[model samples]
Target: MTNTPQPVPASQPIPDSTAAMKSAVKWGVMGLIALAVVGALLAGLFAGKEGVYGALIGAAVGGGFILFTALGVLLTAKLPALTAGAVLLGTWLLKMILAMVVLFVLSDMDFYNKTALVLVIIMSLVVVLGAETYGVLGTKTPYVDPTPSSNVDDDE
Candidate 1:
């Protein structure tokens, strides 16, 4: 008797988008915390308590923005594909405007070192973004076939 080849599974286990987003947020937060600690330490070493406070403030602001964006993405994940893009674009624009306003307000404050705050904010943003990118790219996912298969062979 001749043996027939077994059919391969239609799809392999793939990483879920929601799960990937969650992982990214978790890692991003951790990275932000680490960056904040480092920034605080550096500030304290160079400019004492004031600098440390500035660094902490900057880290807080940056972390807030990152978390806010992440939450928006998670919330929009359930939207229809066509609408999701437009909603995400709108969310991004709003976030940018809000962040700019907050930064402008913070810049006017005299209590903290502006230089330290600005530097930490920039650095923390980079860290969080990088972490999120890494998380998304690192996840394993399977490609789906768009076309359905028919039991009958095309060739007769």
Candidate 2:
């Protein structure tokens, strides 16, 4: 019955900055993995022998970039969860568009590489579905409040 406000833990907020960043990093990592697999397949199927090495390098570099960018976006307190989600989602959509463009362009040239195209297509599907899955699961993660006497305690 006391109107006294209790200290709340930092985790329960929907716009939790930390969770937002963590989710960003996680989704980004997953996307990078899908891309890496596709890239490796592309190299093995199209780039000849040296392409394998190049593909590995590409995977590492690409994954690193995504990870860092995601981390950066999430690390800042100024960015909200919606913003983080938008950035990550936007990047993924843009990449898919670019891949489609490449596929169409290459197909026009009569130089269609089935392996590469299929890899891209599959990767895109996985990324989209995985993102959705993460979206559902990410929100389910429990946020713990450090302060037990916070307003949140009243709700419980």
Candidate 3:
């Protein structure tokens, strides 16, 4: 019969799962932003003066909104359930505010571009909700205890 104890290893490796996932999301968002910028530039070059300008405005506004989507996801991941909901709602509101700001700026530049601004706002709202709805609702996973408790009794 052996009662020997095993030695535990020191210096555990730091887990990078979350960091890696976040980095992947951030880079993905960045790639989309780059595409939007290029589209805006091409629109400006090929489309008429107003069309080009409107696209550039949309790209700026939409890019900011998209960036917030990633930021909100990252921030919510670091928060507790209720706090994450709060942050998600706040991020949505911020996106709305930015959309409004974009509208105001674009409005002053051109009269016919109002529709585009509205579209931007609607699209931003949809994207933010679509991306974050799951996250906000996903915090309440059922808890399961693996260890057996000592309180159970068989004699009723």
Candidate 4:
């Protein structure tokens, strides 16, 4: 038997990112929540009630931003590429505005520890983003072939 090169065929539709996004969202959420618990505990230990409050708020804001982005992509997966892109962009802008408003409002409040809040928020972002990346990279996808349809007899 001789081995010959097979002619490549036309490309196919791009694979949907829903599965990957789902994986990302699921793991990212778990990681963020885990961080929230740990951060809250540590902060509470160090600074008391104010620390606890700060940790919770910070975790929500930092992790929530990225999680919402994943959700936006997952939700818009069925739409046309351009449409989905537009929707995601809009969602991102909205999230940014809301985050700014929330932070601005929180700035004046003296109920929470600012240092704890900032640290936990930054940590939450790093942990959740790492988890999301792991989920996406670890996902299993079916192989894609660009070869023409099979020419062998089915019943041979």
Best by lDDT: 4
**Candidate 3 residue runs with Cα over 4 Å from true position:** 1-17, 48-51, 111-156
lDDT of each: 0.81, 0.55, 0.56, 0.89
* Candidate of highest TM-score: 4
lDDT of 3: 0.56
**How many pairs of residues collide in model 3?**
0
Query: How well is each residue in 73-142 modelled by candidate 4, as lDDT tens digits?
Result: 8899899999999999999999999899999999999999998899998998899999999989987654
The estimated TM-scores of all candidates read 0.76, 0.40, 0.54, 0.82
Q: Residue 85's C-alpha lDDT in candidate 3?
A: 88
Candidate 1 CA-lDDT value:
0.81
In the range 1-156, model 1's lDDT, one tens digit per residue, is 443444456695445658778877888888889999999999989878889999998898887788778877878898998787888788788878988898888776787888889899999989999988887777665455434456746555
Q: What are the runs in model 4 whose C-alpha is more than 4 Å off?
A: 1-17, 145-156
Measured over all alpha carbons after superposition, the RMSD of each candidate to the real structure, in angstroms, is: 4.6, 7.6, 7.8, 6.7
Q: If the candidates were sorted by their lDDT against the true structure, best first, what order would they fall in?
A: 4, 1, 3, 2
lDDT of 3 by residue, 41-155 (tens): 5554655555445555665576567667667767677668899888889889988887787666655565334444344435544443444444434334324443455796655
Ranked by TM-score, the better of candidates 3 and 4 is: 4
What is candidate 2's lDDT per residue for 1-156, written digit by digit as tens?
656545546685545535645665667567767676767666777756445445554454334534544555555446777886777777667666764565465454433334444544455445544653475466644456434543456553
Question: Model 3, 127: alpha-carbon shift in Å?
Answer: 11
Sequence-dependent TM-score of model 1: 0.76
